[model samples]
Target: MQKLSELDHQRRIRLVDLHEPQFERDYPHIDRNAALAALHGELPDGQVLKGLDTSHRAWSLVGRGWLTAPLRWPLLRLVADGCYRLFARHRYRISLWLTGRARCDGNRCGPKT
Candidate 1:
């Protein structure tokens, strides 16, 4: 997330900590429990979007837009979604293997639970 925030030179993305006290007050429409379980997005118009597809679309705004452009193709999008799910499911384990840490502390990766 820090890397992605740095890449967002326009400062368009707001990184909100789910555990923060003000999270519910600020994003009243979002269900904290569900958000902790998966990626979620609240658009400017208050539309709540979820899953890796929404995440990739949001990433398109940054310099990495080209990477997600292939998602326009239906087949590639389907494959990408599957890969995203797999990654999300085992991300903590993958982080442990790659970085020698669970990467869950400080809510850096995702919910501790």
Candidate 2:
């Protein structure tokens, strides 16, 4: 938690647990441009950053496969498949963290009500 606090303090990352009521209240007001700006600010000067994220659903598998279709000749599919299986089995929540698909139906993800 301390490390997370430090990271948040530095604006290196914004941690939002979907189950938090505050997120429900603040989601509508979060400015995507400002979030992008914060992300850029967290990086070192003169560095460039680009983000690519997708849902953890079946359709996204096709999207990812299509996006990397050009690299099939180099056996990249094996690597991508391995990563997908690993995350799906052990770190599925992390895989869907940004998408909020991992939120518990109950209050299990955050403080109990």
Candidate 3:
């Protein structure tokens, strides 16, 4: 497990403080099955909030050696694989967009489609 930089650590704390309350307000009735899917686990809402608070902090701290650590290597690989899958799914559309952007007069993506 890699350690977080001081700046990243502060950022994570601020983000958690900002978002934790929103999560509580947004999912007051988080026991509902519909809420379970959004919670990302079977844990109660408060626990879910805590997990998210930590997970998102970890996410923000990625790419600073943490991503390449033994514990996070597989997760990073999975993220890369997911990116490839997304590119495959939207390859043609992305290509078309790029092509249009290349031919744009300035930087307007080819006259707004």
Summed backbone clashes in each candidate are 0, 0, 0
TM-score of 2: 0.28
TM-score for candidate 1: 0.79
**What does candidate 3 score on TM?**
0.25
Best by lDDT: 1
For candidate 3, give the lDDT of residue 104: 29
If ranked by lDDT, best first, what sequence of candidates would result?
A: 1, 3, 2
Model 3: CA > 4 A from native: 1-73, 101-113
Error of 3 at 65 (Å): 19
Using Cα atoms with residue i matched to residue i, what is each candidate's TM-score against the true structure?
0.79, 0.28, 0.25
lDDT string for model 1 (1-113, tens) is 76788888998888898878899999888898778766788778877777765677578768686776786578787887777778877878888898776767764655345
- Per-residue CA lDDT of model 2 for 1-113, tens digit only, reads 23334434334443454444575476554444433322211123433322222121211233333543533435764676556455544443673576656634453542223
lDDT of 2 at 64: 35
Ranking by TM-score: 1, 2, 3
Best by TM-score: 1
**Residue pairs in candidate 3 whose N, alpha carbon or C atoms collide under 3 angstroms:** none
